[model samples]
Target: MILRDVSFAVAPGESLAIVGSSGSGKSTLLGLLAGLDVPTRGSVSLNGIDIFALDEDGRARLRGELAGFVFQSFQLLPALNALENVMLPLELAGAKDARQRAEHSLAQVGLSARSLHRPQHLSGGEQQRVALARAFVTRPRILFADEPTGNLDHATGAQVIELMLELNRAQGTTLILVTHDVALAGRCGRQLRLEAGSVVQ
Candidate 1:
């Protein structure tokens, strides 16, 4: 099992960080919580709804409606420009104001000037900013970030972290992150330490 006897609760608008050494199941726990993966045992619930009780499509719909995600790889599509990439999720959700919201999100991440640039044309920091803009464009209630700063240098990563925290506070979004960076984990309202797939603290 990738995770065992791992349990925790996050209050609304709280920031919780999961920290673990390599191979300790930090990302696995994040995936399960996000409903991207189902646990072999136990269940995950969001807002009192047991997500695993729903069908796969139902879980996906729930994620689109209430959750956002950021990854270590910055997962932007190579074919889409910054603005278009940010607009994709909103468009998928059938929002009529996708373009406007995408613009505002890009501006929030200090990427307004690079709105027309594709992922490959941007620097690592700029690309990650675009990813952040995309994640927050929908104003999701919960944001899950897995090693969001792992691909950046120290300075750029710090900037990204600051931006995430600012947005989380401003929007009252519940923030859950998986990280190996102790300093980054320390900034959260609470931290859960894991060892060998189980909660150690």
Candidate 2:
């Protein structure tokens, strides 16, 4: 296997950090682990469910049930308010009180005053906070964060990272973070190092 034979496991409620430079397949491994993509030669199981065995719709459903993600770019809909953006996944799951839950989530990320603001109206850090709120509103079993601090300045990024860690501890939610930042990765309980599309250590 050119990508290398890698085998490891994350305990329930554990946080695993993946660190590598760009093009090292850190993001690719995360995508597979989160069921956003399937591996060509290996199997990935999330919460004991084999993701590759499921069809696309099935994978989507499973992901909805178990996974959440925060990407580097802050993937929020430009037209949606902070509240609406956070409510999306919850509403998709048919939560009757999505609005209230979304409001609480936004507040947790310190964006209460900006709840009615759209992405374009917010600063980069604020928009990233919105993305974090949206990813976490569902209270997913696992969260995959790809370079979550990539867009923020040091102070803002530190606050955001603290929020994520706090949520993980309080909820016992598993976290898998892919990043090139060594300091950020060090905060995680266990670390997985990747190089050239392979797990190196």
Candidate 3:
């Protein structure tokens, strides 16, 4: 098992950092928390609902309603411009003003000028900013970030970190991030250290 006997609780509007070396099950734990993976045992609850008790479609619906995600790779569709990337989630959720909300979100990330540019045309930091805009556009109750700054240079990563924490505080979005950077983990309200698929702290 990639993860075993791991358990924890995150409060509403809290920021949590999960840290560990590679192969310590950080990503796997994230997937389970996000309801993107089903554990062979144990339960994960969100907003007082047990996610694993629901079917895949049910869990998906819950995610659509409450969750936003950022990834190390900046998981934007290459064909979609920054604005479009941000709009995708809002559109999926049947928002009537997806364009306006997306534009505002991109502006929040200081990417209005780059809104028309696709991922290929943007720098790594810009792409990640776009991803951030997309994640926050939904204004989700929970935000999951998996190595969100892993690909950026140190300076760029710091900028992204600042923006992320600022946004989290402003929106009261619960932040759950997996990272190897202790300094980054220290930014969270609490830190959960993992070792060999278990919580060591």
Candidate 4:
């Protein structure tokens, strides 16, 4: 499989939006950059480290150290409550105060009242808020969000977007967002247009 020779860079503390129609390879590009997926050709680098040169375990370590992700589908573990879902990563990272950190992060997303509620018990917007808490709990240097607002109504989506930008601003975390929404794309600081698996702009 060819990677189609696309190249781009996101500055630290910047927000870059990737926009295109469906099937335009926006998600693939994101996966490669975030080290979630590998490319057959070329390479990906983050913070001066070449990702493609790393073995799988090395890449996994890099992801844990550098990246956070939010998806359109709230990929929360069904059995875990909001707090538990947010605690998962912190625990995995061996943080001694995982529960405390998780609680704070959930509260940051305004889900403190629903901490005991499982994903199924929460509404769409609430579920996404839980996801947002989980994504930021690690305080990752970079975040990749794929259509984070795709599952919400317009008003709810706007609120979610606002929270995301707020966190990005406060933490100076680099953000790369993939979306088909033109209005959402405009809100980002930089825009990359993709077509046929290549950056067109």
Per-candidate Cα lDDT values, in order, are 0.93, 0.88, 0.94, 0.91
User: Considering TM-score, which of the candidate structures 3 and 4 is the better prediction for this target?
Assistant: 3
Kindly report the root-mean-square deviation of model 1 from the true structure over all alpha carbons. Answer: 0.7
Summing lDDT over every window of 10 consecutive residues in candidate 4, give the lowest-scoring window.
1-10
How should the candidates be ordered by lDDT, best one leading? 3, 1, 4, 2
| Whole-model lDDT, model 3 | 0.94
Q: lDDT (0-100) at residue 14 of candidate 3?
A: 96
Tens-digit lDDT track for model 3 on 35-130? 999999999999999999999999999999999999999999998999999999999999999999999999999999999999999999999999
Q: Which tens-of-lDDT digit does each residue in 38-93 have in candidate 4?
A: 77678888989999899999999989998999999989999999999999999999
Q: What is the C-alpha RMSD of each candidate to the true structure, in Å?
A: 0.7, 1.2, 0.8, 1.1
The per-residue C-alpha lDDT of model 2 at residue 182 equals 69
- State model 4's lDDT: 0.91
Structure candidate 3, residue pairs in collision:
none
Candidate 4 segments exceeding 4 Å error: 1-3
Highest lDDT scorer: 3
Q: Residue 74 error for model 1, in Å?
A: 0.6
Error of 2 at 64 (Å): 0.3
* Model 2 RMSD, rounded to 1 decimal: 1.2
